[model samples]
Target: MPQPRSTRIAVIGDIHNHWNAQDHLALKSLNADLALFVGDFGNEAVEVVRQISTLDLPIATTFGNHDAWYTATPWGRKRCPYDRDKEDWVKQQMALLDHADTGYRHQDFDTVSVVGGRPFSWGGPEWRFTDFYGEWFGVHNFEESAQRIQEAANAAAHDTLIFLGHNGPTGLGKEPEDTCGKDWRPIGGDYGDPDLAAAIAAVKASGKSVPLVAFGHMHHSLRHTKEVQRTRLCIENGTVYLNAACVPRIMDTEIGTQRNFSVVTLQENQVTEVNLVWVDEGLAIASTECLYTTMKVTEHSASV
Candidate 1:
Protein backbone atom coordinates (compact mmCIF):
# COMPACT_ATOMS: atom_id res chain seq x y z
CA MET A 1 0.00 0.00 0.00
CA PRO A 2 1.17 3.49 -0.76
CA GLN A 3 1.57 6.07 1.97
CA PRO A 4 -1.14 8.69 2.41
CA ARG A 5 1.26 11.51 1.52
CA SER A 6 2.19 9.96 -1.78
CA THR A 7 0.42 7.46 -3.99
CA ARG A 8 1.70 6.80 -7.46
CA ILE A 9 -0.75 5.48 -9.99
CA ALA A 10 -0.28 4.45 -13.60
CA VAL A 11 -3.19 5.25 -15.86
CA ILE A 12 -3.78 3.23 -19.03
CA GLY A 13 -5.97 4.87 -21.58
CA ASP A 14 -8.08 3.19 -24.24
CA ILE A 15 -6.25 0.11 -25.30
CA HIS A 16 -7.60 -0.66 -28.71
CA ASN A 17 -5.55 -3.84 -28.75
CA HIS A 18 -2.37 -1.77 -28.55
CA TRP A 19 -1.03 -3.72 -25.61
CA ASN A 20 1.46 -6.53 -25.25
CA ALA A 21 4.17 -7.90 -22.96
CA GLN A 22 6.18 -4.73 -23.43
CA ASP A 23 3.41 -2.70 -21.83
CA HIS A 24 3.49 -4.84 -18.72
CA LEU A 25 7.23 -4.42 -18.50
CA ALA A 26 6.93 -0.69 -18.96
CA LEU A 27 4.33 -0.43 -16.24
CA LYS A 28 6.49 -2.45 -13.87
CA SER A 29 9.41 -0.15 -14.55
CA LEU A 30 7.35 2.83 -13.35
CA ASN A 31 6.66 1.15 -10.04
CA ALA A 32 3.21 2.59 -9.68
CA ASP A 33 1.38 1.45 -6.57
CA LEU A 34 -1.91 1.04 -8.39
CA ALA A 35 -2.97 0.79 -12.00
CA LEU A 36 -6.18 2.40 -13.23
CA PHE A 37 -7.32 1.23 -16.63
CA VAL A 38 -10.09 3.19 -18.39
CA GLY A 39 -11.12 0.26 -20.59
CA ASP A 40 -11.36 -0.66 -24.30
CA PHE A 41 -9.15 -3.68 -24.50
CA GLY A 42 -10.43 -4.32 -28.00
CA ASN A 43 -13.41 -5.49 -30.02
CA GLU A 44 -14.45 -8.24 -27.65
CA ALA A 45 -10.74 -8.86 -27.55
CA VAL A 46 -10.68 -11.84 -25.22
CA GLU A 47 -7.05 -12.58 -25.92
CA VAL A 48 -6.13 -9.04 -24.94
CA VAL A 49 -8.08 -9.23 -21.71
CA ARG A 50 -6.42 -12.55 -20.95
CA GLN A 51 -3.07 -10.91 -21.40
CA ILE A 52 -4.03 -8.11 -18.99
CA SER A 53 -5.18 -10.62 -16.39
CA THR A 54 -1.68 -12.06 -16.05
CA LEU A 55 -0.37 -8.76 -14.75
CA ASP A 56 0.82 -8.89 -11.15
CA LEU A 57 -0.44 -5.68 -9.57
CA PRO A 58 -3.43 -4.00 -8.04
CA ILE A 59 -5.77 -2.88 -10.82
CA ALA A 60 -9.25 -1.37 -11.23
CA THR A 61 -10.77 -1.34 -14.67
CA THR A 62 -13.98 -1.08 -16.70
CA PHE A 63 -15.19 -1.98 -20.19
CA GLY A 64 -15.20 0.39 -23.12
CA ASN A 65 -17.46 0.38 -26.15
CA HIS A 66 -14.84 -1.53 -28.11
CA ASP A 67 -14.58 -4.13 -25.37
CA ALA A 68 -18.08 -5.25 -26.39
CA TRP A 69 -17.83 -4.29 -30.02
CA TYR A 70 -19.02 -7.54 -31.50
CA THR A 71 -21.86 -8.15 -29.06
CA ALA A 72 -23.10 -4.62 -28.49
CA THR A 73 -24.84 -4.29 -31.80
CA PRO A 74 -26.51 -6.53 -34.38
CA TRP A 75 -23.81 -5.76 -36.91
CA GLY A 76 -21.10 -6.92 -34.53
CA ARG A 77 -23.02 -9.87 -33.11
CA LYS A 78 -23.26 -11.42 -36.54
CA ARG A 79 -19.49 -11.59 -36.97
CA CYS A 80 -17.94 -12.15 -33.59
CA PRO A 81 -14.29 -12.97 -34.16
CA TYR A 82 -14.14 -15.58 -31.44
CA ASP A 83 -15.79 -18.79 -32.50
CA ARG A 84 -15.07 -20.28 -29.06
CA ASP A 85 -17.14 -17.62 -27.39
CA LYS A 86 -19.26 -20.27 -25.68
CA GLU A 87 -19.80 -17.61 -23.02
CA ASP A 88 -20.24 -13.87 -23.25
CA TRP A 89 -16.95 -12.22 -24.14
CA VAL A 90 -17.72 -9.33 -21.80
CA LYS A 91 -18.12 -11.73 -18.91
CA GLN A 92 -14.95 -13.47 -19.98
CA GLN A 93 -13.12 -10.16 -19.79
CA MET A 94 -14.68 -9.32 -16.44
CA ALA A 95 -13.70 -12.68 -14.99
CA LEU A 96 -10.25 -12.27 -16.45
CA LEU A 97 -9.87 -9.17 -14.25
CA ASP A 98 -10.76 -11.24 -11.21
CA HIS A 99 -13.88 -9.08 -10.91
CA ALA A 100 -11.74 -5.96 -10.63
CA ASP A 101 -14.13 -4.32 -13.08
CA THR A 102 -15.29 -1.06 -11.44
CA GLY A 103 -18.14 -0.05 -13.66
CA TYR A 104 -21.02 1.18 -11.48
CA ARG A 105 -19.02 -0.03 -8.49
CA HIS A 106 -16.11 0.91 -6.31
CA GLN A 107 -12.63 -0.46 -5.72
CA ASP A 108 -10.92 0.52 -2.48
CA PHE A 109 -7.18 0.84 -2.40
CA ASP A 110 -4.77 2.05 0.29
CA THR A 111 -5.89 5.65 0.56
CA VAL A 112 -8.06 6.78 -2.33
CA SER A 113 -10.85 4.73 -3.84
CA VAL A 114 -11.98 4.21 -7.45
CA VAL A 115 -15.62 4.63 -8.33
CA GLY A 116 -16.73 3.75 -11.83
CA GLY A 117 -19.27 5.17 -14.20
CA ARG A 118 -21.06 3.22 -16.92
CA PRO A 119 -19.00 0.56 -18.65
CA PHE A 120 -18.86 -0.16 -22.37
CA SER A 121 -20.09 3.33 -23.15
CA TRP A 122 -20.26 5.09 -26.51
CA GLY A 123 -20.68 8.65 -25.38
CA GLY A 124 -23.32 11.00 -26.76
CA PRO A 125 -26.43 12.95 -25.84
CA GLU A 126 -28.66 10.24 -27.28
CA TRP A 127 -28.61 6.66 -26.08
CA ARG A 128 -28.29 4.27 -28.99
CA PHE A 129 -27.41 0.82 -27.62
CA THR A 130 -29.98 -0.32 -25.09
CA ASP A 131 -29.71 -4.10 -25.02
CA PHE A 132 -26.07 -4.08 -24.04
CA TYR A 133 -26.48 -2.01 -20.84
CA GLY A 134 -29.77 -3.68 -20.04
CA GLU A 135 -28.39 -7.19 -20.12
CA TRP A 136 -24.98 -6.67 -18.54
CA PHE A 137 -25.47 -3.77 -16.09
CA GLY A 138 -29.29 -4.00 -15.66
CA VAL A 139 -29.48 -0.32 -16.53
CA HIS A 140 -32.01 0.77 -19.14
CA ASN A 141 -31.95 4.54 -18.82
CA PHE A 142 -29.75 7.39 -17.64
CA GLU A 143 -31.61 7.75 -14.34
CA GLU A 144 -31.00 4.16 -13.23
CA SER A 145 -27.46 4.24 -14.52
CA ALA A 146 -26.73 7.46 -12.68
CA GLN A 147 -28.14 6.00 -9.50
CA ARG A 148 -25.84 3.00 -9.73
CA ILE A 149 -22.79 5.19 -10.19
CA GLN A 150 -23.80 7.40 -7.27
CA GLU A 151 -24.40 4.36 -5.15
CA ALA A 152 -20.88 3.26 -5.80
CA ALA A 153 -19.60 6.64 -4.70
CA ASN A 154 -21.86 6.60 -1.71
CA ALA A 155 -20.37 3.27 -0.72
CA ALA A 156 -16.78 4.34 -1.24
CA ALA A 157 -14.49 3.75 1.75
CA HIS A 158 -12.33 6.80 1.17
CA ASP A 159 -13.06 10.47 0.97
CA THR A 160 -10.71 11.09 -1.94
CA LEU A 161 -12.19 9.24 -4.88
CA ILE A 162 -11.04 8.63 -8.42
CA PHE A 163 -13.84 8.19 -10.92
CA LEU A 164 -12.82 5.86 -13.71
CA GLY A 165 -14.75 5.50 -16.91
CA HIS A 166 -14.45 4.51 -20.56
CA ASN A 167 -15.80 7.86 -21.69
CA GLY A 168 -15.50 11.05 -19.65
CA PRO A 169 -18.49 12.61 -17.90
CA THR A 170 -20.54 15.43 -19.39
CA GLY A 171 -20.08 19.19 -18.55
CA LEU A 172 -16.41 19.18 -19.44
CA GLY A 173 -16.89 20.92 -22.78
CA LYS A 174 -18.70 20.58 -26.07
CA GLU A 175 -15.90 21.61 -28.42
CA PRO A 176 -14.59 19.00 -30.82
CA GLU A 177 -11.20 18.76 -29.13
CA ASP A 178 -12.49 18.97 -25.56
CA THR A 179 -11.76 15.91 -23.44
CA CYS A 180 -15.02 14.09 -24.25
CA GLY A 181 -16.15 16.15 -27.18
CA LYS A 182 -17.44 14.65 -30.41
CA ASP A 183 -14.67 14.92 -32.99
CA TRP A 184 -16.42 13.04 -35.74
CA ARG A 185 -18.00 14.78 -38.81
CA PRO A 186 -20.35 17.42 -37.45
CA ILE A 187 -17.57 18.11 -34.98
CA GLY A 188 -18.91 19.94 -31.93
CA GLY A 189 -20.88 18.51 -29.06
CA ASP A 190 -20.42 16.93 -25.65
CA TYR A 191 -19.77 13.26 -26.32
CA GLY A 192 -19.84 12.56 -22.58
CA ASP A 193 -22.20 10.25 -20.70
CA PRO A 194 -25.13 11.99 -19.10
CA ASP A 195 -25.53 9.46 -16.32
CA LEU A 196 -21.89 9.65 -15.47
CA ALA A 197 -22.20 13.40 -15.38
CA ALA A 198 -25.15 13.30 -13.03
CA ALA A 199 -23.43 10.82 -10.76
CA ILE A 200 -20.28 12.94 -10.60
CA ALA A 201 -22.30 16.01 -9.72
CA ALA A 202 -24.16 14.11 -7.05
CA VAL A 203 -20.96 12.68 -5.59
CA LYS A 204 -19.32 16.09 -5.38
CA ALA A 205 -22.41 17.55 -3.86
CA SER A 206 -22.20 14.89 -1.17
CA GLY A 207 -18.92 16.51 0.00
CA LYS A 208 -16.44 13.91 -1.22
CA SER A 209 -13.02 14.94 -2.43
CA VAL A 210 -12.78 13.77 -6.03
CA PRO A 211 -9.14 14.14 -6.99
CA LEU A 212 -9.36 12.85 -10.52
CA VAL A 213 -11.63 11.38 -13.15
CA ALA A 214 -9.58 9.51 -15.73
CA PHE A 215 -10.70 7.84 -18.91
CA GLY A 216 -9.81 7.16 -22.54
CA HIS A 217 -12.15 6.67 -25.48
CA MET A 218 -11.60 9.89 -27.33
CA HIS A 219 -8.20 9.35 -28.91
CA HIS A 220 -5.65 12.15 -28.66
CA SER A 221 -5.15 11.99 -32.38
CA LEU A 222 -8.14 13.78 -33.87
CA ARG A 223 -9.97 12.83 -37.02
CA HIS A 224 -10.77 16.39 -38.05
CA THR A 225 -7.22 17.72 -38.32
CA LYS A 226 -3.66 17.21 -37.10
CA GLU A 227 -2.95 20.86 -36.53
CA VAL A 228 -4.01 20.53 -32.89
CA GLN A 229 -4.19 17.61 -30.52
CA ARG A 230 -7.24 17.00 -28.37
CA THR A 231 -7.41 18.65 -24.95
CA ARG A 232 -6.74 15.89 -22.47
CA LEU A 233 -6.92 17.64 -19.10
CA CYS A 234 -9.61 19.68 -17.38
CA ILE A 235 -9.61 21.08 -13.85
CA GLU A 236 -12.96 21.89 -12.37
CA ASN A 237 -13.97 22.23 -8.70
CA GLY A 238 -10.59 20.89 -7.57
CA THR A 239 -10.94 17.69 -9.60
CA VAL A 240 -8.68 16.91 -12.51
CA TYR A 241 -10.24 15.13 -15.47
CA LEU A 242 -7.76 13.46 -17.79
CA ASN A 243 -7.97 11.66 -21.11
CA ALA A 244 -5.11 9.18 -21.36
CA ALA A 245 -5.94 7.80 -24.81
CA CYS A 246 -2.71 8.50 -26.57
CA VAL A 247 -3.56 6.19 -29.43
CA PRO A 248 -1.05 3.75 -30.91
CA ARG A 249 0.43 3.88 -27.38
CA ILE A 250 3.17 1.77 -28.86
CA MET A 251 4.97 4.01 -31.30
CA ASP A 252 8.32 4.13 -33.04
CA THR A 253 10.33 7.02 -31.71
CA GLU A 254 13.71 8.21 -32.86
CA ILE A 255 15.42 5.97 -30.34
CA GLY A 256 13.12 2.95 -30.72
CA THR A 257 9.56 1.83 -30.33
CA GLN A 258 8.30 3.19 -27.01
CA ARG A 259 5.31 2.47 -24.79
CA ASN A 260 3.22 5.26 -23.27
CA PHE A 261 1.61 5.39 -19.84
CA SER A 262 0.24 8.26 -17.82
CA VAL A 263 2.07 8.55 -14.51
CA VAL A 264 -0.04 10.35 -11.90
CA THR A 265 0.93 11.03 -8.32
CA LEU A 266 -1.30 12.19 -5.53
CA GLN A 267 -0.19 13.75 -2.26
CA GLU A 268 -2.26 14.47 0.82
CA ASN A 269 -5.14 13.02 -1.19
CA GLN A 270 -4.75 15.66 -3.88
CA VAL A 271 -3.24 15.27 -7.35
CA THR A 272 0.21 16.82 -7.61
CA GLU A 273 1.73 15.75 -10.91
CA VAL A 274 0.88 13.89 -14.11
CA ASN A 275 3.12 12.93 -17.00
CA LEU A 276 2.89 10.89 -20.18
CA VAL A 277 6.11 8.95 -20.02
CA TRP A 278 7.41 7.07 -23.04
CA VAL A 279 9.40 3.96 -22.14
CA ASP A 280 11.98 2.83 -24.61
CA GLU A 281 12.88 -0.66 -25.87
CA GLY A 282 15.19 -1.13 -22.89
CA LEU A 283 12.24 -0.42 -20.57
CA ALA A 284 13.65 2.94 -19.46
CA ILE A 285 11.75 6.22 -19.54
CA ALA A 286 12.77 7.62 -22.91
CA SER A 287 10.73 10.81 -22.77
CA THR A 288 8.03 12.53 -20.73
CA GLU A 289 5.39 15.19 -21.24
CA CYS A 290 3.95 16.87 -18.17
CA LEU A 291 0.20 16.70 -18.52
CA TYR A 292 -0.76 18.51 -15.30
CA THR A 293 0.75 19.40 -11.97
CA THR A 294 0.30 21.52 -8.90
CA MET A 295 3.69 21.09 -7.22
CA LYS A 296 6.99 19.24 -7.48
CA VAL A 297 6.79 15.47 -7.10
CA THR A 298 9.36 15.64 -4.31
CA GLU A 299 7.02 17.84 -2.36
CA HIS A 300 4.69 14.88 -1.98
CA SER A 301 5.22 12.00 0.39
CA ALA A 302 7.07 8.83 -0.52
CA SER A 303 5.71 7.57 -3.85
CA VAL A 304 5.08 3.94 -3.08
Candidate 2:
Protein backbone atom coordinates (compact mmCIF):
# COMPACT_ATOMS: atom_id res chain seq x y z
CA MET A 1 0.00 0.00 0.00
CA PRO A 2 1.19 3.57 -0.69
CA GLN A 3 2.17 5.50 2.42
CA PRO A 4 0.07 8.36 3.80
CA ARG A 5 1.45 11.89 3.41
CA SER A 6 2.81 14.28 6.00
CA THR A 7 0.77 16.99 7.69
CA ARG A 8 1.76 20.68 7.51
CA ILE A 9 1.04 23.06 10.38
CA ALA A 10 1.50 26.83 10.58
CA VAL A 11 2.40 28.44 13.89
CA ILE A 12 1.76 32.17 14.39
CA GLY A 13 1.19 34.42 17.37
CA ASP A 14 0.98 37.94 18.84
CA ILE A 15 -1.37 39.25 16.24
CA HIS A 16 -1.95 42.55 18.02
CA ASN A 17 -5.03 43.39 15.96
CA HIS A 18 -3.21 43.58 12.69
CA TRP A 19 -3.61 41.15 9.76
CA ASN A 20 -3.15 43.17 6.64
CA ALA A 21 -2.91 42.20 2.99
CA GLN A 22 0.72 41.27 3.41
CA ASP A 23 -0.07 38.99 6.31
CA HIS A 24 -2.81 37.30 4.30
CA LEU A 25 -0.42 36.70 1.44
CA ALA A 26 2.14 35.21 3.78
CA LEU A 27 -0.42 32.82 5.33
CA LYS A 28 -1.61 31.67 1.92
CA SER A 29 1.91 30.63 1.01
CA LEU A 30 2.13 28.01 3.72
CA ASN A 31 -0.75 25.86 2.41
CA ALA A 32 -0.94 24.19 5.77
CA ASP A 33 -3.52 21.65 6.89
CA LEU A 34 -4.15 23.85 9.92
CA ALA A 35 -2.93 27.07 11.56
CA LEU A 36 -2.42 27.58 15.28
CA PHE A 37 -2.45 31.08 16.76
CA VAL A 38 -1.19 31.58 20.31
CA GLY A 39 -3.19 34.77 20.95
CA ASP A 40 -3.23 38.52 21.66
CA PHE A 41 -5.76 39.46 18.99
CA GLY A 42 -5.97 43.00 20.46
CA ASN A 43 -9.00 45.35 20.53
CA GLU A 44 -10.02 44.72 16.97
CA ALA A 45 -10.56 41.09 17.88
CA VAL A 46 -13.89 40.83 16.11
CA GLU A 47 -12.68 42.20 12.81
CA VAL A 48 -9.45 40.23 12.88
CA VAL A 49 -11.21 36.94 13.62
CA ARG A 50 -13.66 37.56 10.83
CA GLN A 51 -10.87 38.25 8.38
CA ILE A 52 -8.93 35.14 9.33
CA SER A 53 -12.08 32.98 9.13
CA THR A 54 -12.27 33.87 5.47
CA LEU A 55 -9.12 31.85 4.85
CA ASP A 56 -11.31 28.72 5.16
CA LEU A 57 -8.56 26.77 6.93
CA PRO A 58 -9.08 25.31 10.36
CA ILE A 59 -7.60 27.57 13.10
CA ALA A 60 -6.85 26.83 16.74
CA THR A 61 -6.08 29.58 19.22
CA THR A 62 -5.62 30.45 22.87
CA PHE A 63 -6.43 33.84 24.33
CA GLY A 64 -3.45 35.97 25.40
CA ASN A 65 -3.20 38.73 28.04
CA HIS A 66 -4.26 41.32 25.50
CA ASP A 67 -7.20 39.17 24.45
CA ALA A 68 -8.39 38.79 28.03
CA TRP A 69 -8.23 42.52 28.55
CA TYR A 70 -10.49 43.16 25.59
CA THR A 71 -13.43 41.94 27.69
CA ALA A 72 -12.19 43.08 31.07
CA THR A 73 -14.81 45.18 32.84
CA PRO A 74 -13.69 48.68 33.79
CA TRP A 75 -10.11 47.89 32.94
CA GLY A 76 -10.93 46.84 29.40
CA ARG A 77 -12.97 49.91 28.57
CA LYS A 78 -10.36 52.13 30.13
CA ARG A 79 -7.62 50.54 28.07
CA CYS A 80 -9.20 49.94 24.66
CA PRO A 81 -12.79 51.33 24.94
CA TYR A 82 -14.03 48.73 22.46
CA ASP A 83 -14.87 46.18 25.18
CA ARG A 84 -17.98 44.02 25.73
CA ASP A 85 -19.51 44.58 22.32
CA LYS A 86 -16.45 43.56 20.37
CA GLU A 87 -15.66 40.78 22.80
CA ASP A 88 -19.12 39.28 22.40
CA TRP A 89 -18.85 39.50 18.65
CA VAL A 90 -15.45 37.82 18.71
CA LYS A 91 -16.81 34.91 20.76
CA GLN A 92 -19.65 34.43 18.32
CA GLN A 93 -17.20 34.31 15.45
CA MET A 94 -14.97 31.84 17.28
CA ALA A 95 -17.96 29.54 17.80
CA LEU A 96 -18.64 29.67 14.10
CA LEU A 97 -15.14 28.40 13.50
CA ASP A 98 -15.71 25.68 16.13
CA HIS A 99 -12.91 27.00 18.34
CA ALA A 100 -13.03 27.38 22.09
CA ASP A 101 -11.60 30.61 23.48
CA THR A 102 -9.59 28.69 26.08
CA GLY A 103 -9.24 25.35 27.83
CA TYR A 104 -8.55 21.74 26.75
CA ARG A 105 -9.67 20.96 23.20
CA HIS A 106 -8.41 18.27 20.86
CA GLN A 107 -8.59 17.48 17.16
CA ASP A 108 -7.36 14.71 14.91
CA PHE A 109 -6.51 15.26 11.25
CA ASP A 110 -4.96 12.49 9.19
CA THR A 111 -2.01 11.21 11.24
CA VAL A 112 -1.85 13.99 13.88
CA SER A 113 -3.69 14.95 17.06
CA VAL A 114 -3.54 18.42 18.67
CA VAL A 115 -4.40 19.74 22.14
CA GLY A 116 -4.54 23.50 22.68
CA GLY A 117 -5.36 26.12 25.35
CA ARG A 118 -4.33 29.44 26.91
CA PRO A 119 -2.86 28.56 30.26
CA PHE A 120 -3.39 30.76 33.28
CA SER A 121 0.14 31.49 34.40
CA TRP A 122 1.15 33.14 37.64
CA GLY A 123 3.24 35.61 35.70
CA GLY A 124 5.49 38.52 36.64
CA PRO A 125 4.22 41.53 38.63
CA GLU A 126 2.62 43.22 35.63
CA TRP A 127 1.04 39.97 34.56
CA ARG A 128 -0.42 39.52 38.02
CA PHE A 129 -2.30 42.76 37.56
CA THR A 130 -3.56 41.47 34.24
CA ASP A 131 -4.52 38.18 35.87
CA PHE A 132 -6.60 39.95 38.49
CA TYR A 133 -8.37 41.81 35.75
CA GLY A 134 -8.77 38.57 33.85
CA GLU A 135 -10.42 36.95 36.86
CA TRP A 136 -13.03 39.68 37.00
CA PHE A 137 -13.67 39.15 33.31
CA GLY A 138 -14.18 35.38 33.58
CA VAL A 139 -10.72 34.05 32.68
CA HIS A 140 -9.47 30.85 34.32
CA ASN A 141 -6.86 30.86 37.08
CA PHE A 142 -3.49 29.13 37.24
CA GLU A 143 -4.51 25.96 39.05
CA GLU A 144 -7.63 25.56 36.99
CA SER A 145 -5.76 26.01 33.74
CA ALA A 146 -3.05 23.58 34.79
CA GLN A 147 -5.58 20.86 35.55
CA ARG A 148 -7.14 21.31 32.15
CA ILE A 149 -3.82 20.88 30.38
CA GLN A 150 -3.02 17.77 32.35
CA GLU A 151 -6.39 16.20 31.56
CA ALA A 152 -6.02 17.03 27.88
CA ALA A 153 -2.61 15.40 27.71
CA ASN A 154 -3.87 12.34 29.53
CA ALA A 155 -6.79 11.94 27.13
CA ALA A 156 -4.88 12.47 23.92
CA ALA A 157 -5.41 9.46 21.57
CA HIS A 158 -2.53 9.90 19.14
CA ASP A 159 1.20 9.25 19.37
CA THR A 160 2.08 12.52 17.68
CA LEU A 161 0.95 14.95 20.37
CA ILE A 162 1.09 18.66 19.52
CA PHE A 163 0.54 21.04 22.44
CA LEU A 164 -0.45 24.66 21.88
CA GLY A 165 -0.29 27.44 24.43
CA HIS A 166 0.04 31.20 24.77
CA ASN A 167 2.92 31.38 27.25
CA GLY A 168 5.61 28.74 26.87
CA PRO A 169 6.51 26.20 29.52
CA THR A 170 9.27 27.41 31.86
CA GLY A 171 12.78 25.95 32.22
CA LEU A 172 13.96 26.41 28.63
CA GLY A 173 16.60 28.93 29.79
CA LYS A 174 17.41 32.04 31.80
CA GLU A 175 18.92 33.90 28.87
CA PRO A 176 16.81 36.65 27.29
CA GLU A 177 16.85 34.72 24.00
CA ASP A 178 15.43 31.53 25.43
CA THR A 179 11.73 30.55 25.23
CA CYS A 180 10.98 31.80 28.73
CA GLY A 181 14.07 34.00 29.09
CA LYS A 182 14.16 36.79 31.66
CA ASP A 183 16.52 39.62 32.59
CA TRP A 184 16.95 39.93 36.30
CA ARG A 185 20.05 42.11 36.16
CA PRO A 186 18.69 44.36 38.91
CA ILE A 187 16.40 41.90 40.70
CA GLY A 188 17.77 38.78 38.99
CA GLY A 189 15.60 35.77 38.07
CA ASP A 190 13.58 33.86 35.43
CA TYR A 191 10.28 35.39 34.25
CA GLY A 192 8.48 32.24 33.12
CA ASP A 193 5.32 30.82 34.72
CA PRO A 194 5.93 28.12 37.30
CA ASP A 195 2.44 26.69 36.89
CA LEU A 196 2.97 26.18 33.16
CA ALA A 197 6.39 24.65 33.67
CA ALA A 198 5.11 22.28 36.33
CA ALA A 199 2.16 21.18 34.23
CA ILE A 200 4.36 20.47 31.23
CA ALA A 201 6.79 18.55 33.41
CA ALA A 202 3.98 16.41 34.72
CA VAL A 203 2.70 15.76 31.22
CA LYS A 204 6.14 14.65 30.07
CA ALA A 205 6.52 12.55 33.18
CA SER A 206 3.31 10.77 32.19
CA GLY A 207 5.20 9.30 29.16
CA LYS A 208 3.14 11.01 26.47
CA SER A 209 5.59 12.16 23.84
CA VAL A 210 4.93 15.73 22.82
CA PRO A 211 6.67 16.35 19.50
CA LEU A 212 5.80 20.06 19.17
CA VAL A 213 4.76 22.67 21.74
CA ALA A 214 3.80 26.00 20.15
CA PHE A 215 3.41 29.19 22.21
CA GLY A 216 3.74 33.00 22.22
CA HIS A 217 3.62 35.90 24.78
CA MET A 218 7.34 36.14 25.65
CA HIS A 219 8.23 38.31 22.71
CA HIS A 220 11.63 39.91 22.11
CA SER A 221 11.53 43.47 23.36
CA LEU A 222 13.57 45.72 21.07
CA ARG A 223 12.96 48.73 23.33
CA HIS A 224 14.88 47.23 26.23
CA THR A 225 17.70 45.58 24.25
CA LYS A 226 18.28 43.76 20.98
CA GLU A 227 20.02 40.84 22.62
CA VAL A 228 17.07 38.44 22.15
CA GLN A 229 15.63 39.28 18.77
CA ARG A 230 14.69 36.41 16.45
CA THR A 231 12.49 33.32 16.05
CA ARG A 232 13.30 30.64 18.70
CA LEU A 233 12.76 26.89 18.11
CA CYS A 234 14.45 24.34 20.34
CA ILE A 235 14.22 20.58 20.81
CA GLU A 236 14.73 19.21 24.28
CA ASN A 237 14.11 15.63 25.41
CA GLY A 238 12.39 14.83 22.10
CA THR A 239 9.90 17.69 22.39
CA VAL A 240 10.16 20.71 20.10
CA TYR A 241 9.34 24.01 21.88
CA LEU A 242 8.63 26.96 19.61
CA ASN A 243 8.23 30.54 20.81
CA ALA A 244 6.05 32.29 18.22
CA ALA A 245 5.77 35.78 19.69
CA CYS A 246 6.97 37.64 16.58
CA VAL A 247 5.99 41.20 17.43
CA PRO A 248 8.84 42.78 19.37
CA ARG A 249 6.87 45.87 20.41
CA ILE A 250 3.38 47.29 20.92
CA MET A 251 3.82 50.02 18.39
CA ASP A 252 2.01 49.98 15.03
CA THR A 253 3.83 48.04 12.36
CA GLU A 254 5.92 49.81 9.70
CA ILE A 255 6.31 49.31 5.97
CA GLY A 256 9.51 47.28 5.97
CA THR A 257 9.02 45.55 9.31
CA GLN A 258 8.92 41.80 9.00
CA ARG A 259 6.50 39.39 10.68
CA ASN A 260 7.72 36.08 12.11
CA PHE A 261 5.99 32.68 11.83
CA SER A 262 6.82 29.00 11.40
CA VAL A 263 5.85 26.00 9.29
CA VAL A 264 6.18 22.44 10.64
CA THR A 265 5.95 19.18 8.70
CA LEU A 266 5.16 15.85 10.32
CA GLN A 267 5.44 12.52 8.52
CA GLU A 268 4.59 9.07 9.88
CA ASN A 269 4.15 10.49 13.39
CA GLN A 270 7.60 12.15 13.37
CA VAL A 271 8.64 15.71 12.76
CA THR A 272 10.55 15.86 9.48
CA GLU A 273 11.02 19.61 8.86
CA VAL A 274 10.55 22.97 10.54
CA ASN A 275 10.90 26.31 8.75
CA LEU A 276 11.30 29.60 10.58
CA VAL A 277 10.04 32.15 8.09
CA TRP A 278 9.86 35.95 8.07
CA VAL A 279 7.56 37.83 5.72
CA ASP A 280 8.10 41.42 4.55
CA GLU A 281 5.49 44.19 4.44
CA GLY A 282 4.91 43.57 0.72
CA LEU A 283 3.74 40.00 1.44
CA ALA A 284 7.02 38.63 0.08
CA ILE A 285 9.17 36.08 1.87
CA ALA A 286 11.95 38.02 3.54
CA SER A 287 13.69 34.93 4.84
CA THR A 288 13.19 31.19 5.36
CA GLU A 289 15.36 28.78 7.30
CA CYS A 290 14.87 25.05 7.80
CA LEU A 291 15.65 24.97 11.49
CA TYR A 292 15.49 21.21 11.94
CA THR A 293 14.89 17.87 10.21
CA THR A 294 15.04 14.21 11.13
CA MET A 295 14.64 10.98 9.19
CA LYS A 296 13.54 9.11 12.31
CA VAL A 297 11.73 10.07 15.53
CA THR A 298 14.56 8.86 17.77
CA GLU A 299 16.72 11.88 16.99
CA HIS A 300 17.84 13.85 20.07
CA SER A 301 17.31 17.48 20.88
CA ALA A 302 19.40 20.13 19.09
CA SER A 303 19.35 23.95 19.04
CA VAL A 304 19.67 25.87 15.78
Candidate of highest lDDT: 1
Clashing pairs in 1: none
Question: After superposing candidate 2, which stretches have Cα over 4 Å from the reference?
Answer: 1-4, 72-77, 83-97, 100-102, 119-141, 183-188, 227-231, 248-259, 279-284, 295-304
lDDT scores of the candidates, listed in order: 0.86, 0.64
Off by over 4 Å in 1: 1-4, 83-85, 295-304
**Model 2 TM-score on a 0 to 1 scale:** 0.77
- The alpha-carbon lDDT assigned to residue 43 of candidate 1 equals 86
Candidate 2 lDDT, tens digit per residue, 8-68? Answer: 9888878888776667777877787888878776653666766666666766666666654
| TM-score of each model, paired residue for residue | 0.93, 0.77
